[model samples]
Target chain A: MENACCIVGLGAISSIGLDVEENYESLQSLQSGISYPEFLQTLHKTDLPVCEIKKSDAELAALCKMPLGLPRTVYLSAIAVQQTLAVIANHDMSKLRIGFISGNTIGGMDRSEYFFTDYLQNQSQGQLQDIRYHECGSITELVAKHFGIKHFVTTINTACSSSANAMIHASRLLKNNKLDIVIAGGADALCRFTLNGFNTLMILDSEPSKPFDENRKGLNLGEGAAYLMLTSEAIRSEYNLHKYATLSGYANANDAFHQTASSAEGNGNYQAMKEALAMTGLTTSDIHYINAHGTGTGNNDASEGIAIQRLFGENIPPVSSTKANTGHTLGACGALEAVYACLGLRDQVIFPNLRFETQMKDLHFSPDTKWQATKNMQHIMSNSFGFGGNCTSLIFSKDS
Target chain B: MGVYIQGIGNISAQIFDPRSQDFTLHAGHGNRLICIEPDYKDMIPPMQLRRMSKIVRMGIACAKAAMQDAGIVKPDTISLGTAYGCLADTEFFLQKLITQDESMLTPTAFIQSTHNTVSGQIALLLNCTGHNFTYVHRGHSFETTLQEAFMLTQENVNCNALIGGIDELTNNAFNIISRFGTYKKEDEHFNNEGKGCIAGEGANLFVVNAKDTKSSYAYCSDIHVCSTENIAEELDGFLHVNQLQASDIDTCLLGLNGDERYDTIIANNIRNVKNARTISFKKYCGEYPSSGAFAMALACKLLQSNTTPMNLQDLNAPLNDEPAQRVLIYNHYKNQYHSFILLNRL
Candidate 1:
């Protein structure tokens, strides 16, 4: 279909790796990147494990060729976006109607948190430059302006589902002929604000997260940025682009059950998965694998597991949560997992759900804990459920 | 096909009601424009009201009000745009995390601090399990939300999308932003040739449908976003795309804040517009990032009432006194992000 949104380029920066190739390598070897915070200066750093990218903001800035003292979010986003654009460097970018749609929970909060430490005491004490890019759009603008993306630029902040919605919106825009190419995904940097915020919620597991495990404690906070260059099938054909995968179906549904908790019945999760599959005109058996949101939280695993059971029922696919390796990256997780899904489809492999032992009693299926090569793996489902009851499911089909 | 604004509910610096031909614009207090809020008891439940921050309260109240005005108990989708999301909650959590060393922090403030809290709350309140999204793209936040809603309606004819734009002006935000010189001096207003604009906060919600209903205020014909460079060319293209000309527009609403530095671009662009009565909305709603929403609401009001409000001003040369059948809204933020919205009388 000419309306199909094709993923032509991929970029990612997380604890496991700095770019898509490194991330894929780490995933293949089951190299978990969870460790205690070394770069982040926090009181709870010793207790809380995180998927830090193992680089300071200065190192990231050096990599992105941008100035230091800016928010880490900017550096991460710039690096990922640069890598994404590098894949399409052979194409005449200026000739195409290009746009950038990014998703981030806190714009420059990494810098703003430092500014707030002083400004909270005295309004005039903080550096103006530190807090200048505090708005989420500001991060988007800094990157877009640097890369010269002036056509369409926006930000989505639906908690964890932020980047998933960004991809969804980008596809809609492409399907509607609003833009020929869109760099759509999200980024986030580890900071005290989110650390303590999630800490206060008491969902921070002391160890690396074990998603879908029966004895899962909670989610370990992680930080990263990932992006996918999506283009219309027409543009893909015209440019003879190297296709990674096709963004077949997606849906955003509200749980409406609680402010931060998923429903017991996983109503929103079920609806999002159901609707996404419906959009693809595919049945449960058509889906080859599932990348579960599976935050390793007691609430999320149960709710999401029950929803998966309700949807696929007896013929559940090999489901796994990569958060065990990357930790829950929150806003960036959706797109991060999406890149991984594309990688899985490309290689016809199912990356195991790391550190899973006992299965949840609420469901009949256990997440695949061993990496294995598979045949005829055509479609993979990625789930992202966030705070405020925001649930989104995205389905990616292997390029035929 | 264009989407119709079936209903509007605004909680802004001004008292706006589409049903009322005559309305009042409350004067801003010092350098900031505060919303003249309504009682929350009527719109939200008491228990839920206590947990919600000021922005959430205003957002949910106005969303419910818009839904009620649209004569629907639930909408097919709920989307919101907020530039500064849940400032009070964010500030509360940040301050507590700082002062108390993040030791005894609670989850309430942190829970409410996310940008989608308001939109999520609206969905939870109505038990409307549909598509929910929140855009925080600075100036184009609301316009992006409107665009998303418009696309949904165009894709699905039976979709009724509840969309809104909201932002709150907290004390800390005001103080810090004042340091950035975003607001005029305390002694200065628009009339005094100020270098900055007043800080404004508001929640404007609308129920839009692809099919026009009896309660529809106006039909939103087109919405376009463009960069600062080649704005005049883009403006002409926008009009041409809509099968219109400068003369076809009865009223052109420009986002001209009192700030001379930023308003110059808007001022310079108006030269390309001819035979259209130009109106500035910042004078009434003050200046906020998503104030384009207020401009669109005002355009709907003018179209619905068929009479101009008492205190409305024409920034450009006066034109014929005919009621506006076609309205064009041009808004830019920091001269960086610009959008044009066209509305027509039903």
Candidate 2:
């Protein structure tokens, strides 16, 4: 089979670690990154825990070589993107028609909130510059400029499923022969606005998230950025480089069941998974591991589990939700988990779904609670479902 | 691959129905803000209507109208593009968090605050769980969705895709934008009187299909979205890639919103596209983030009607028998992000 899109390099910053190696090390050790919020100044810090990246905005700005006063999201994205690009530094930045697509939920909210308070005090002159960064696109534009990418840049903000859709979009563009090199992923930073928003919804877990557990509470908010360098087969062959994993198939569907809650039957999730497998020409038996969205919410886990059960039947693959490790990174969760999927292939290990006790009575399947290495890791399917019933499934395979 | 615009619906400052002969223009309310309050109850059911924000309501209303216009009961896909999604809800949630100290914040506002809420709601409403996505790339948000629709068409995946772009203005949102100096102050609008205009909100939806139905208004030939500091170089590169010369463009729709700072950049590019008729829509639609969607809707109507609306006609070029063969829409939001869309009548 011809590889549709090849992942050349990957980078990520999460509560687990700062880079790919660090995150992989933490994952292999079965360490959870969910802890009390430290950096974000919020009133609910004590009540709600978060998977926050252990870095300040100034430190991240310095790490990304960004100027002072840059939006915190941009700074985080630049660090992750720069790390990914470092692996492919020999590639011609000027000759290659490079493009970027990022998914971020609260783009530049850190800056927007700052200016929102200032505007109320009648201080508005220097504020226009911040306005440019208020929308999701501004982060993409800033990252593209920092990386010297000049073509086909945009941002997708479909909540938790944003970066998964971003990855799908990048793959489709490459399959259509639209560009040579594309950087696709998502980044998000912990903020008081999001912290309180989730808290108000009464979905924030007081303790660490227990995904797929019998007594699972709500999710723990997280912040991070991750990106992958996707190139076509021709480009990979010309460069004489090894592709980590082939992004074989991807699909997105709307749950449309609710504004926030998925349907009881998980129709959208089922359709997305079915379409993705169908596109890849693979059956449920071919898949060795499943990276579930498993936000630890009562509704999401139950709905997603039902959908997975419907698709795979009794022959369910070993499944784990990385959200227990990285928290629910929202827009960046998809990309963050994509990096973890590649790691699963390289290491031949299925990371544990931490804090699982008993299976839900509604479903027979249970996520792998212990990390185990397997040889037949050919295909790994990951699911990312967001608000607005936006659901996406991505299939990655070792053999192209 | 041919993608036809089967249905078009828009809710802007002006009446955007294609059947209408003239724009049902409204008087500017004192500060240069133009708003169109649609009777959304006609399109949305009362049960679902109560929960929707202004952006969601406008989006549902416009999407419903577009589906009706296309005579399609169920669309295969729903794709929405919004520069800022559910800002009103977002602001509400944020305000609750800040003012109430994050206690008892309503779930409704938080639920509708995601960027994909509109597209998700549309899918849920139609119960069409096929393919759904949303793009939030500022000025090129809708164009990116159009590009994705074209790719889907080329793949023969779905026959029809409902694509739309929407943005709503809230008081906090406007104030935030004003603080950045991106928005014209009330004093500036009052002093210049007619010089600078305030921002507005709107929703534009289109039913795009792979087949070229006779009802097609025009064919979207190509769309190019790039981020560059040098406007001249980017413009030249876009035209060169399409194998089109500057003179080949019969009319160029420029995004000029009376802001002298940014309008000059567009003006300089228009001057380079020699022998092409120029037009602007900012005065009519105001300067919202996704105003480009409104511009695209106007282009479709112009191609179909064979006449440009008088309110939008900046350059008085006589209509020719050539039938507005090629139309180029050049849009820039905040003078930082730019997009160019090329459309040709089939």
Candidate 3:
């Protein structure tokens, strides 16, 4: 029998709210985190709408209780990590053997960019330390240190699919008996580096992102972090822990069709979903809802819609893209959506896919744009597709 | 439960292949740092070559060579582990962003900057749309990739998997890391002199399979990764789990860069293994986050040759035996991450 990996705790901070509860409440009320850029100073500030966190660097650092002068990304990640750790307080810190895996595309880039111009002039001496935080692993190291975790630690940087891949790696390690407990998720803070990068790609939507809509322009770049505490069933049972949801199946596949674009038919996304379903031994009928990867971009929504249509046939499950609320959190979207899936299973509710309107002419399906509470929700699938044709699908189910 | 390395291909600073039999060690670029990249035109087609960066070229070359070595036309899965994926492309895109102010930036460079580009490109090249994933966790990146491959093989998901670690050197990257004191500056160059062990890059590919072939060099017994500030305790625990004592290891592959501060951790770890002869590869391969892959490739070659190269030998200890049966490879990057990989002759 496959060992069940259970999520004991979940924490999230996005443009919507600070924790899971607040975010859920906002989702229920149709509150959009999307707004005109205020925190990030960029050339496209007037043109782009982002789902940015309300906290400042100093405020976030204080909330995380981190040392001063830390990178913004680390500060935000520590906040979410500490919140998740608070729930599993009873678990032994010394003998638990916890591992940490994070996903981030731009780690400490906000700080690094500040130091970049100054360092070039050889005028700043202390700023050189900021360069250490440029690598993706540095923030993960900082988070691990905050919790005193010494076991396996890693950072995944496959763009949008980073956190989804991180979650998959964590679950796989738990199943292989490599780790007893693991905290896996991702964080990406807003900065001119990322904002400008997306702007240059011409994928930043001026208005609110409309995922799977015919008139969708592009994505709204958002920022924040989310993480889950995953442990083997044996550990959970031994500790008498409350399970949030079970990570039933996950699969990662490469599109190999383009460097940044998905295949014309979404081959990689389809294969990943198929394999994830196969791993769980679950039929299409078993899936209750799907949290789509819909970034509101012309390419991603269309590709992911085609993949979803191919997987479930014409009668698709009620699918929705929460990017309307959180924008595209990039690396954190996978874990963020995973947390949403768990919440769906817990409350027996399907959150509305905000900003979704007319179905695409290329596909014959529409998303559930209205929030509804239903009973007996079983399986929920979440998808995250990234720049390198990296596609990941994770299935979370209620404990039987 | 052991994973066998059926075939291996490596492109490093030293040419250590059976066909070439060229074990000559060449220092990288300046002083003692340089990356020895092969002529990839012979391996990759011209059309693909235009879009390929150094990392991509090196990865494709090594992957093709590994598949050829394993006598397999196509692998069931492709997994790549890279710390900084496609650094050349990343630098190119960053340069365009900074200089051009984000206008008319080529999408090609920006698209290829992702960590999974190597695995995705390899899959495209072969047209085998099997399981493909990439791990980008600093030093432990390659170890985790192999661990996943081992798990998949154990699960019978695929009998054979193509796994490799590839990182490329860039001028801007070196300059940036040098400013951070991670790499040795020219003024403080005397301490890091003679051994020009700075950040260098190349690719090392391996074909790991459930079926043990007669040509297998070694079987991977186990692997571990830890992020503890205390190295000694982690080492002891890792050794204890394998029912191994430090003295039982016949050889130790240490990732001792010429850096004074970071090399101490490696030296202290080697002190635990009293009876083992220490071997260092960074002096030849230079230093990169995923350089452990190079050390692993060297371990497989040592198993096959039944001999250690003089260039790799540590002057402090002499080889006790002509052929070593067991090897312990320990590597760390800047004291932040550490990994232990155990290999034995099959």
Candidate 4:
């Protein structure tokens, strides 16, 4: 029998909040964390709005009890993973086989870009320590070592959908009986490299993002880290764990349409949602809420909306894009939104999509724009699509 | 279930033409072993080829060649691993953005700077809308790709996975990594006792299926990656689970990169094995995060030919006269990321 992956703990550190409780409170009050950049060293700070965490790198390091000079990505990840490990503080976890699967597009580019400024001037001038954590895997290794997780650790980079893939890979490990507990998520820090990269693509919105809206200009880049602690069914039963939800179904599909853009018809989006639902043996009407991958971009919202319409049709559930609040945390959005989805099941509340005024012309359904209490919410779906046409949808069902 | 290596393609420091009998091994040139790239005119169109970065071109060429060798038009899945992905493009955009003050920059380099660009471009070129994935773990990157491919084939019997591992060594990357004592100095001698190994880069791809076919090179039975202190015990457990022993392995491909710090893991395992012929592969391909792909390709070549290649006869010592049937590949990166892959002939 295939083992069911259970979500026992959740940790999140984003622009709106520092912990899951803070995030939930913000979601309850319909507060958006989108603002101008204060920490990232970029020239377009005034012109570009981002969902940047207010803490500086040094502040974050001090807060997380980590070394001062490590990459901000490491600091953010340490904070989130620390919170995640807190759930099992009373239990001795060293005996269990734990796996750490982290996803990120930018590893230490926040510092590597600074290293390059000097190295590009003179080949041997830059400090080698700055580029030490340049590889994406290095971030995971540091965080894993910090938490003393030594069994199995890996890194995945599938652009914006990176963490979603990490969670899926973690579930696979659980199903294969390779691990007892898996902490999977992703983290990305705002750096000049990615900011300029998005700017070059003409996708950075000057204002707060408006996902699933007719006037959606583009996505505001964000920085954050989030993680979900999953365990095998056997481990869950053995521990008699307090379950938030069961990661009942998930799937990954390739659009193959474009490198950075989604197809108009959302082929990959449709396939991923369909496959995930099929895995859960659930029909369209069963999903009570959807945390859409609506990045407020012209291509993503329309494509995702069309896919939702095609799948749910007249019986579309309460759908909302938290990107308006979180400002599209890139690689971390998948797990971050996943935590929100679990909160929807736990607290029975459907978080609102902020700044959404007019509906898009292609879709018939309008997203939920106000925070409302939902009764008897059973299953919530979280969608994450990224560059390279990587699309993933994860379904979390309330524990009966 | 084990997966069959139906086809293989590699672009490495050594000459990698499968049809040609002559395999020329290139020595490291001043602490770097650069890939002897083949002309991509035949594999990629001129218009699209113009905009591709070096790693992307190498990746696409290898993927296409592997597909041709497998005689398949499309694969059921596309997955890959790269430690330093599209370094040239990343450097280009970052340099331009910094030099131009982050204004008036073009999007081409920025668009291709992502780590998944090669896998994405290959999917775009092939129009294969399968489940695409990319892994960026330092040393275990390629092993994770293989594991995912194995799981896909295990889940769906009809799945054919086109998977590979690729890394490109750019000038800036080499210089930065060199500062961290990752590579030998240009004036230093190349010896096992040295502190650093030669830096290298390549793209090695394979077409894998669940069942053995007429063109099968070898069957990958098991793969494991972990960070452990007692490698000898781990090796015993791995072999025990696979229903094998140290003596059952005919040959063991060891990643003995010249560095003593890194080679200790492989050295510790070599002391425990009894009868397996130990051979180090880093001399041919040098040291990179995903160099295990090159080692796997070499293992597949040996298994397919049922004999040692002439170029690798003196890796550590002369190969055993008997034809090898089973091979074990053990590799590690910076003494942390350890992996073992077991391959056997049909």
Candidate 5:
């Protein structure tokens, strides 16, 4: 039997809020975080809409109790990790063999860009310390150092699916008896690099994103951090920890079709969902709610919608994309949405998919437009698909 | 569920096979030791080569060669490790954004700038829909990749994973980092003594499978990664689990850069294992995040022949005994991340 990897603690910092409860409160009221850029200064700031956290770098650093000059991503991650440690505060962390696996795409581009801007005009103007944060793993390393975690710290960078992959790897480690406790999640901060990158792709939606809608334009790139404290069932018992949810099933697959786009049929998406369900020994019927990847892009919603129908068939349950609530966070979306799934399971309420008027012409069902109270919300399936055809599906079961 | 290395492909500072009986050494002088990369046309298509950076070229080449040596068209999974991924592209795009206006910037460089591009590219080329992963921890990058691969063997008895560690050296990166007093100085430089590491870069790939084959070099017995202060305790615990003692390790491959600040962890961990032969690989390969992968390839070569390379011997710590069965590798990055890998001769 596969060992159960229970979720004992959860932390998230998005545009909506700085902590789990605040974000959940927003979700309960169907408050979306999408807005005009505030802190992210870019040429496209006036042109594009993004779900940016309304905090200055100094403000974020103060919130995390860290010094200035820290990367925005590091500050965001410190907030989330603080919240995670808060929930699991009573447990003796030193006794357990802990491992931290983080998912991040933009390591410290925000800082690096500033350094480069200064250095371009003058060769020696850029701070050398800022360059140290360029690698994706540095986010986790810095966070780990702050928390005094020394074992098995690493980072994953698979575009949007990075955090979900982090969760999968963490669960595997716990199940395989490599680490007793694992904190796995991801973080990314808004910067000119991502804004221009998405702009160059011409996928930044001018208006708020409309996921799973026929009139959906494109993704509204967002930024934040989310982390989950995962522990083996035995460790939970030993610590007498309260379980928020149990990571019942998870799987990853490559689309092998395109670099940034999903296949028309969403073959990789279908395979991931199938294998995730297989891992849990559950059928499609067991999933009560589905948190679709739904980036609100023309290709993703259609592709993911098709894959949903192919997997669940005529009896598709309450399904929606929270990307409409929180813009596509890229690497952070996986864990951000996973936290949302956990919230849904705990609250037994499905957050409304903010914007959906007409059903997507290509799909049979439109996303649940209003907040729906689900009955027997035992299992919630969350999907995160990213660039390079990386697709992942994670199923969270109610803590029984 | 034993995992054995079935194939090896390396693009070190010198583009040579470690498994070859006779190999040419690329002794780099001074503080920079860039890789001697192969022709792009040899592995990638003409159009593909034009789009990739040097790191991607080396990554794809090594991954393809590993698969080729394993006699498989596609691997069951693809895992890549890079401390600083595609820095040249990242730096290039950053320079353009700084110099040229960002309004008309193209997405090609941005699209290819992500850390996961090489692994994704490999998966796309092979059309393997298996799990694709990329790790980006500093010193523990390759260790974490192999650790995850090791864990995969427990889940599935029959699994084949294409694992690689790649990083590139750029003049700008080198110049910028050298200011931190990281690289040794030999002249009127930062240190003014010019005794720093010869900054090296390369991509090393290995095909690891649950089952051994005729081409298998050695069995990868175990691996451990930690970030604690207890180096000796961790080493003792790791060897204890594998039914090994200090004397059992016939060869100890240490990640000893010329820098004295970083060699203490390695020195203490292997202090009790005085009976085993010790070799330092950083001299030949230079120092990079994933140089451990190159060290592992070198360890595999050492296991096959039990003879340490002439260029790899640590002059101060020469071996009194010949290598035999077991080789233990210990590597750390500036006292932050530590990794241990144990391999046994096939």
Candidate 6:
């Protein structure tokens, strides 16, 4: 890992905790953020348990100086990015050409759902500026403008694998010497559009999700934001930035089998993982931990487990799905789990996979249910598979 | 490494079918420039075609046509850009969720509602297991996809990447956006009432590889994406890096949506590059965030034909006496995301 793009700072606002340190503490303490929704204004709030941030929109809005009527997605992004910038407060701001590569699925649909409903009822009832942030890049543009990061700004929306692809591009930009500093991550807040969308898909587990379990019913949806500050060797040396971990390799592949469901053999997942490991020239023995994209759905867990068994054979590392804790953050899970992986590297510990009892009947390996600390925490892999069969995998290793 | 645009596919507000040798030039006559729908029954099976929205069908059709023109079976990679992805589905799902109290909602619309649906579906149809990417950076979406494609082709000259941009408007979306003053009223046009512009959308794609073939229309030399504050200076640096001067550019395509407020940005930025002939492609494709794809398709066509369409012929425009060998496409979204693309005649 010579002159790799190092993770200098991390900012996360998830159900587990509101900031990087809190999130790390929650991971170490094995505290689950899967609780009833407090802020989301959906009818299923009473029936479904979600890992939602406890702050109301107004409370979260007061955290930052944003204009009124912006979507909750923008608020979450601002909170995470604010913390990301705060982590690198000592960096020479004027000298740095910062690039904000944010990933989001539904930009302001949380607000748009409200606006459009009002508009449907009465065309003139909704505020004019509310629906303006409906597009996916709208939040990225707003956050970039707020942070004054104009050098290289972009947004990726590959469903669940979005933030993983965002990190892939961010690392590539740094490796290509396009930007000095890259803030790469994603943010997605819960809205009726996504909630009912998943509900219609009939994958929303009413109870806590158990990944890699045989009877795993479905996924418990969640909402949050996470960002990692990526800095190259030149910027690292110039600014004397502290490296938390190294983003060594990443790969993206399509299943080409189905739109929402993965292939029966998990072709895309296997290819993504194999290529990512090949990128770093690392073997299965070298990988210390596996942060699986175990969404608790029957199709996803079985397919991902098969992919893992194919890659690792009989020798599998400690595998876990933090979704049991933070729920699936949709697009932000990549960066959220990325921050968790960096924590594993920095602290040399493997977090527990919450609420897992039985292994899937179809697979040889089951996710680690209890928190386990480890000494040889070196290379870690994170997987994020999305709808339309878009799959991505990322590797993080100790900054040598 | 240079990327050669080996093939192009365009389905837009204009009736210029790329499959035909001659293009039927459609002038900028109306504010609501609607895309001339293509017959998908020719390319897609009924099963797949039934579930796809207008944008998804258009994307798949364009991608298939582009691959056919390039003599490639399947692209090694697929990257796409879209301002509003599957908007028809998004709107449908939203309307259902709101009206139906979030119950009894169908998953079909929700499944196709993602921004990457178009690119993912293209790969699925082609069985392309290679790299797949989608960019949603408003105006920079198309340019970012081109940049990703350039890097891929540069990495391996043998690699052929299918990259494109697609955007389609729904009726409710258009109505709401128009009310937000996005589009000029039909009667309000032809006056200095620069408060609104025409609404338009399209799907355009190009097959790019590092090697040139008989189908190569132009060579994509460089692409620059930046903020709109200093477009002139940034474009100068971009051209200088490519060893091209402003005068070296034979044709320049700018996005002038008839909105004096935003179009004036380009006018002021290019006030100095007086020697290059400038034309606005929005007249044909109208205006959309991903309109740069239409502009790129037009550049490929102009470079291949060695002649500008009569509809865009400006007698007083700075037309180079020499044959048009190079073309530049520059566009922005609401005076924010600035993009410049350089294409050279093969």
Indicate which candidate wins on DockQ. Answer: 1
Q: Write the per-residue lDDT of candidate 2 for residues B193-274, one digit (tens) a residue.
A: 3334567888989998877778887888777775567777878888898888988888887887777777777887666787
Give each prediction's DockQ, rounded to 2 decimals: 0.84, 0.66, 0.53, 0.81, 0.75, 0.79
CA deviation > 4 Å runs, candidate 1: B26-29, B319-321
Comparing 1 with 4 on TM-score, the higher-scoring candidate is 1
lDDT of 2 by residue, A115-230 (tens): 65555456443366565587888888888888888778888988889999999899988888888889999999888778777876777889999888778889999999999989
Which of the two candidates, 3 or 5, achieves a greater lDDT against the reference? 5
Instruction: Name every residue pair that clashes in candidate 2.
Output: A127-B180, A128-B180, A256-B124
List iRMS (one decimal) for every candidate.
1.0, 2.1, 2.6, 1.0, 1.3, 1.2
Candidate 2 Cα outliers beyond 4 Å, as residue runs: A1-3, A117-132, B23-31, B185-197, B227-245, B306-311, B315-323
TM-score of each: 0.98, 0.94, 0.94, 0.98, 0.97, 0.97
Native interface contact recovery, model 6: 0.80
**How are the candidates ranked when ordered by DockQ, highest leading?**
1, 4, 6, 5, 2, 3
What does DockQ come to for candidate 3?
0.53
Off by over 4 Å in 5: B186-195, B309-311, B320-324
Instruction: List ranges where model 4 is wrong by over 4 Å.
Output: B18-24, B187-189, B314-318
lDDT of 4 by residue, B90-178 (tens): 99998998788889999999899999999989988888887888999898889999988878898898998999899999988888888
- Which residue runs of candidate 3 sit more than 4 Å off their true CA positions? A119-126, B18-22, B27-32, B185-197, B227-240, B244-247
Q: Write one digit per residue (lDDT tens) for candidate 3, span B1-346.
A: 7688877778887776833334566544443355567777788889989888888888888998888988888888887888877777765666566566556665677677777778878888887677777777777778877888878889783578998787887776777766555666554332354423466787899998877778887888888776566677878888898898888888888888877677766888667787888887787677888888888888887777756666657878656546667888889877767788899876
* DockQ of candidate 1 compared with the true complex: 0.84
Q: lDDT at A258 for candidate 1? A: 96
Better of 2 and 6 by DockQ: 6
* C-alpha DockQ for predicted model 4: 0.81
Model 5: docking quality category: medium
lDDT of 4 by residue, A21-134 (tens): 999998888888888888888888799988989998889998789898888999988899898878788887777999999999999998888888888798988778788999
User: Number of backbone collisions per candidate, in order?
Assistant: 0, 3, 4, 0, 7, 1
